[model samples]
Target: MSAVVDMPGAAHLVLADGVVHLDPEPAVLEAMLEGWALQQRTRFLNWESTIRPRIALVRRLTRFTNEYPWQWDPAEVEAFFDHLRTRRPGRPLAVSTARNYQNDLRLFFDYITDTRYGWPSMCNERFGRAPVQLLHEWNTITHTSEYEGAAERRPLAYDEVQTLFDAADGRVGEIRARRRKGSLAALRDAIVLKTVYAFGLRRQEACGLDLCDLRRNPRVADYGRFGAIFVRYGKASKGGPPKRRSVLTVPEMDWIVGVLDQYVSEVRPAFMPGKHPAFWITERRDRMSLRRLNEAFETARQAADLPPELDLHSLRHSYVTHLIEFGYPEKFVQDQVGHAYASTTAIYSHVSDEYRNRLLRRSLQARHGDLWGQET
Candidate 1:
């Protein structure tokens, strides 16, 4: 009924359906064993069952860990991601449950190994076998498929971002009236959205602010010149340190502080929780929800008639694009946007060919002492 092979120093298991031989090729055998160990480590933690979403979270965490061999194998890594790529939000799964099945799998296989340890494992143990083959299938199928979301990144135009901001501002006003019946609440939301664009904060970072944190920052050389908002949580947190990050720019800092002062003086006390440690308060006066902030941002974008795909995160993209358009170097833009990878900033640099040529021609004119000719 089933094919079987035996080899020295090997074990075999036979079942009604077939026989499974552990006499794998040396490379295959080593990869399998390492994968097993990684799975066991993942299972012991029970992280997906307890902490994060079911699919690919363990793998994501493991990737964050500085482990080896488990982090190295291309096939094993891909297998772990296969589980992730197949996952759908709220779907039950024995392994990988990420929303974007293809992407999760791609990331996993792109970084696995066979000869190191000490870093945490990134594979989901619940998967009986790695789904590395699935990634191959995706690449094969999508090489000519009709699926979307595979498009290259392009920065939103300046007017598009402004319109989205305006939409967000209006919705904040509507929500404030419907929920809290307050004038200042809408104004606060406007200021919050503005700050997000100006400083390119992630939703969590913006919502994680505290009144005290915004009011006081240690990094400012001239505190009076710019507004200061603390970056509390996001991609930049190192070793899970709780130390705050501060962003300062003349008008933006003043805008946030001024709105906050009004909020604290007039609105905050009315909605104050008994003793919550957050700064951005809601109608009931608690720490703002990131989801709610995102929803509000969405509503605003729609109201402003912005493209449907523009999200709160696009503010960060827009910020980077603006910086690049103004001729800031990629490295400087990367630092301002808190990107460890310059490639991320590169996506926002889709400046038009016309714009690029204009700048180039202007540079030549300035060099040749014919600046007014180009200006004319």
Candidate 2:
């Protein structure tokens, strides 16, 4: 047994046999690791999304090196990553994924080594060595580019988007023709896919919507009660609750008004949802889960014979691209998607070549009109 002696800035260890063990056992270090995680939470990082993954990465590093934080070195970091790369020879880790692992390790070490956190001093008093940063600029990946996502994750072309929607609608038709029991569910899935694309919502945001989130826009009275969606569960920044935004139903996507109106007035009530607030309900009268949302997108994508690489998030990308093509301002699109930076919205936009050519033609025509003092 050992006893911990708490001091002003450090903790000293005293063993049962009166011999001081400078380095504490790995099990004893769990408390300190947990404290570090808690400190991150206090700084406004989401517990489940940010802090948990950070702690998990640290634990992974520990397991790979069989060493505690104080004992770790840059060489161990390198070796651990090397092991990861070689472990799956056929499918080595992507550069972006590897970069994330390095960045997480860097942040964890930075926290532990900072004197303000008390971890370095505590480790020094107990182990005679303090935690050192194991990740450095020379060894770690540099974020030189704005986009690091997979090349395959891209916006759907206009035809591809139409095909996906048709497939979703076709599913409902197929079910109805057979008099299947799940036709209502199939139609619900179809509308969900369209809504995600129409509003450029993240999967979680879409799944987290409540019936009341839909509201009537005074200016767009013709759209009825489906004029806008108040997204209360927009993706949050580190340590913040979910962000909120109001996505107004634009004219180009007004077709969703009818679909949503029908769902709310007719289809949703059949689920026997008396008090459930979710806009999308299951047969069990529960809110749709993010997994279910993804499954719906997958079903539609496969039915349309689209690329396997395109996932539900691609719908958001398509929304951004199409909005840009429709001549909306960048800042408006940024706000619509709840992007903190316009650069993030740009990452999602993959405008079509035809749109670019159209823009070029418009510019040329305007120039010729000015030069000739007449219509070009």
Candidate 3:
């Protein structure tokens, strides 16, 4: 029989007869998880980031249900999901997130119950029963829509974007005026928010930026080194390296040129990140974490009195919307954001009311003379 995708170690290898597992059941469970991880890594080429979370989710289910895989029932799986979704009165997991949890659990079941892997026989021999797939079509969440994110997560208005940036900058001033520490860090945060909107970058894409990723555009020499941004960590396809793209600086967003120049020349060196490739550095001379990036944007959002629903990622959404409003070609906007499909880029766009009104006016003016002048 195949050894769990033909991998060795962990689940694939059995303990010797003389070996003593003080906690035998737990040991077997851990071994199963490890074996599953190894199989995913070796056969599927999944990232550790993906494998670790799936393992944790399985463990969490085991804890919540107070049972091993062999003891689990569909009722318990349904109860677990109900508890997760209703834990907070007003909030629940996004459909995508809930589906991911179900999918991971299903994948785990697929691994443990497969006859070729021998997990069923191992469990049967030790515990008088075998593992079975817990998640079924009826018990699992379904993908009903293409975009199932919260409605709150939409594009910010132009004024709201400006207000957020102003708040970020004002934070730096507040630090300086109070003779406080972190003025440099605050300044970096301010520019980072601007760069996010200017480049239409995802969180990982922005965080993964290196100093060398800044490139000159031969077509737009006026902006010099800030003419384009090389996004090395664009969102990846499953089991694939991150997609790469170069976002050219459009004239509408070219204000980032001076802002980035000031940050690189005047502010970045203060972090003392010698030889560190990360463009955004922390005070401790390490690359900034995604948490810190979110915190900075949150601070500014609250200060600006923007809606609580707005988060750092709204800036990327704002970029797509603004580009559409600015009359850029749909294909150009799609390419700039590295979306595989124009439909995906279209999903990001939430154009403002005024832009739609302008389009309506233009259409009416073409059909009749002095249409706006004779309006009631």
Number of the predicted model whose TM-score against the real structure is largest: 3
TM-score head-to-head 1 vs 2, winner: 2
For candidate 2, write residues 95-209 as lDDT tens digits.
Answer: 8999988988888777666666567666777678888987888998888888877777899999999999999999999999998898888889999999999999999899999
Which is better, 1 or 2, measured by lDDT? 2
Give the per-residue lDDT digits (tens) of candidate 1, residues 1-376.
1222332111121111243335422333344334443443444533332223323443453453433333333454455555554666754332222334445444334323211221122122322233232245534223332222324334567777667666666666676667865555555566667778777777878888776665444465444323466676756332233334556553323445555565667656766555887767887767888887887676677688876656777777777777777776788777766666787678555676767888988888788877556555
What's the C-alpha lDDT at position 371 in model 2? 58
Query: For residues 167-217, what per-residue lDDT tens digits would candidate 3 score against the true structure?
Result: 999999999999999899999999999999999999999999999999999
Ranking by TM-score: 3, 2, 1
Cα error, candidate 3, residue 104 (Å): 0.6
Clashes counted in candidate 1 amount to 20
lDDT of 3: 0.88
RMSD in angstroms, all models? Answer: 10.9, 4.4, 2.1
Per-model CA lDDT versus the true structure:
0.54, 0.84, 0.88
The candidate scoring highest on lDDT is 3
* TM-score, model 3 to reference: 0.94
The alpha-carbon lDDT assigned to residue 124 of candidate 1 equals: 29
Cα miss at 279, model 1 (Å)? 1.8
| Superposed model 3: Cα runs more than 4 Å off | 1-10, 14-20, 43-48, 369-376
